[model samples]
Target: MISRLSRELSPHLTYHSLYHTRDDVLPAAARLGRASGLNEDEYLALTTAALFHDTGFIDTYEDHEAGSIAIARAALPDFDYSPAQIDRIADLIAATRMPQRPADPLQELLCDADLDLLGRDDFMRLNRALLKEVRHYSHRPVPDDTWMRDQLRFIEEHRFFSPAARTLRAAGESHNRALMRAALASTNGANHAAGGLA
Candidate 1:
């Protein structure tokens, strides 16, 4: 699945590339799950959710979580997952959508995995890559201040749900949040100086 995604997915996916999914998110999920003390079955379900969470992006740019669920339904049975297991995976995938609402420990782990970069060291570099990705798909450039403000809002509003995720990520996320807040403040100040706030 990941191999096909690496080859067939849009090249414009600067941040959502195979490296993002295969290399980063998958391992991140594993680490978080272990920290969360998930049993073998729960880990399998969560890992599978991580695997297929972004599969919808192959078909559509927005609202890919729904598409990911459809793809999972069709594919999971072949892999010997039961109906209940597939449903759980779908729930976890969908939980990664904006306004992320994870109902269970596993779902919480998946959410943390999805936003692992928010707490990671390379947040700015990857954020810029995501901006490049947006430009590639939309053919429009996001203004620097607007991007910084939006990133600040998102980082400020989001939180890691599980204890393990919070333990693993809170410090890094706080550091990034402070950086984003500083950047946003500077941008706002520059805008006011230019009288753009008017």
Candidate 2:
């Protein structure tokens, strides 16, 4: 399945590519499943949901979550997953969408895992990768100040709903918040200077 995704995924989908899914998102979901003490059924559900979460990007970049759910419904039954299980998996994937309103523990854990970069030391590095991806898909470069400001807003607004994620990475997230603030300040200063010269 992943081999299929690798062949079919768009070059424009840098952030949502096979590597991000295989290396980062999948591993994090497993870790969160363990940490959250999910039962076997829940763990399986979470893992399956994680696998199919961003697959909508395989079809389209915008509002791809709905497409992902569609793909999940079509494919999950082949794995012997029940309709109820497929529905649960689909719900978990859908909750990963922006605004991230998770209605239950499994959804919360999945949502936290999806955005775990928010609380990791490599956040800035990963963020640059995301920005490059955004530029590729959007066909325009977002200004540095605008990017930093938007990041600041997102990090400030984001909160890890899973106790495991918060316990493991809250301090790192705090450090990230400080780093973003400094980066934003520096970018604003530079932009101001540039504007004055213009």
Q: What is the C-alpha lDDT of each candidate?
A: 0.89, 0.89
Question: What's the true lDDT of residue 43 in model 2?
Answer: 98
Q: Please provide, for model 1 over 1-198, each residue's C-alpha lDDT reduced to its tens digit, 9 standing for 90 to 100.
A: 887687778888999888888987899999998988889999999899999998888999889899889999999999999999998898899899988888888888999998999898999889999988987888787888998988898999988998888998899999999988888889888888889656
Off by over 4 Å in 2: none
Quick one: best TM-score, which candidate? 2
For candidate 2, write residues 1-198 as lDDT tens digits: 688789999886767889777877888899999988889999999988888999888888899999999999998888899999999999999999999999999999889888888888889988888888998888887998899999999999888998998998788899999999999999999989999999
Q: Estimate each model's TM-score.
A: 0.91, 0.95
In candidate 2, list every pair of residues with a backbone clash: none
Candidate 1 off by > 4 Å: 185-198
Q: Which TM-score value belongs to model 2?
A: 0.95
Model 1 pairs in collision: none
